[model samples]
Target: MTTPILLFLDINGVIDVEDTDVQGENLPQEYSTVYPVPGTKEFLQVIDSCSWIHPVWISTWGKQSQAWNKWAKTRCWPWAYPLDSDERHQALDLIGHGSDKYLAARWYSRDWQHRIVWIEDGFWLSSLYDSSMGAAVKWAENNSNVKLIDTAPTVK
Candidate 1:
């Protein structure tokens, strides 16, 4: 049997994004509006059809399991599994308080960085928490699989 692909997924800047005229950005970053990024439904349709792609919710937006699952179901977003607050907090402790999303995925994927496919926005962003963090993200980007989704121009 082939090894199934591990997909670590994020909510904001991905399926959800800064709403344009139709909607407004979530100031609190709660993403309550539920404006899906352009082509998100189509992308998820393809992803869900692929038996190999195993997507796991790795962002704080969906840290709450029930809400996240509900959101996924409402939008028909492949119904990815969500990491609860406890699991997310434990992973955060490993890398300290910061926005290094790849690190969080690392814990969830069980250090299977190279094999896992991470879909988030941080890798494409230029800012870095520290030299070490920058290096780590760089290393993961280079080694692990990543799809840097740019939701700059939201599709109306």
Candidate 2:
């Protein structure tokens, strides 16, 4: 069997952002006003076509991921896959105070042997503020198995 790729997706910039650098701790509340990035449907379609890839939400939405899932469904996005509830809860438990996206992605995926693709827009921004985020950027720079799709926040 082919090794399934883990696609860790961030909603703020990679998907929900259009031309604004929307950042806040309001979480699922902030997500309510987000504008879907153009071509997001096509992106979802691509992931859907690739049966060997498993996509999981790694956004700041956090505990409200189910809300995001429901929103995606409303958009008719091919994003029906939900991360295992037990796994997600366990990973969140282990994740410390800071926004260590990479660390969370690692724990969420459960196996580094499989390729990981982190679709995010705040690597540079996050690096400037969060030390863990900075470390994650540095680590992704050297890890061949972990690929970072650093989408620009200004993506229109």
Candidate 3:
């Protein structure tokens, strides 16, 4: 059986700008609205070339799946489907905490322990606390099978 590959994506900072930055003479305006960050589309294309890649959006706005769909369509970020029922419940459980990224990781594909990759900007490498969940995050952080792209835009 082929291992299922899960790609966890973040919205705000990873795919879009979190805030503005002051440059020498030109102030960089923040891209507050949702859109794929630089090189994101190319990255998605590369993953898509792989037959096992399964993309999943892991963001605080996951509750607003519709909004995310619209944004994805606009930016053309590859996606398979909105969060599944189990993932939705998991996200609901993490409501206000900035730990939604960690919560989403817990809701990865059923066989994700074998093959999974989380790509996001908000996830803290050392902040995961839940034993089972923490192990999973650490596995991704340490293993070559997984990757985390901190897409926080650079001020120019």
TM-score of each: 0.59, 0.65, 0.50
26-143 in candidate 1: lDDT tens per residue?
Answer: 3232645566666665666667677777766666654442354443343333323344578667767775553445456555666553356666655534334345335435545676
TM match of model 2 to true structure? 0.65
Off by over 4 Å in 1: 1-3, 21-31, 65-100, 111-114, 124-136, 141-156
The alpha-carbon lDDT assigned to residue 134 of candidate 1 equals 59
Model 2 CA deviation exceeding 4 Å by range: 1-3, 18-31, 63-98, 153-156
Query: In model 2, how large is the Cα lDDT of residue 126?
Result: 70
Clashes of 2: 0
Clashing pairs in 1: none
Q: lDDT of candidate 1?
A: 0.55
Over all chains combined, what TM-score does candidate 3 have?
0.50
Top-TM-score candidate index: 2
Please give, for residues 1-156, the per-residue lDDT of candidate 3 as tens digits.
678777776655665553344111211232234444455546655655666766666665544533444433333334323456776576557432333345446545444565566665534433344453354446456777676554433334
lDDT of 2 by residue, 103-148 (tens): 5666755554778888888677777777767766776788777788
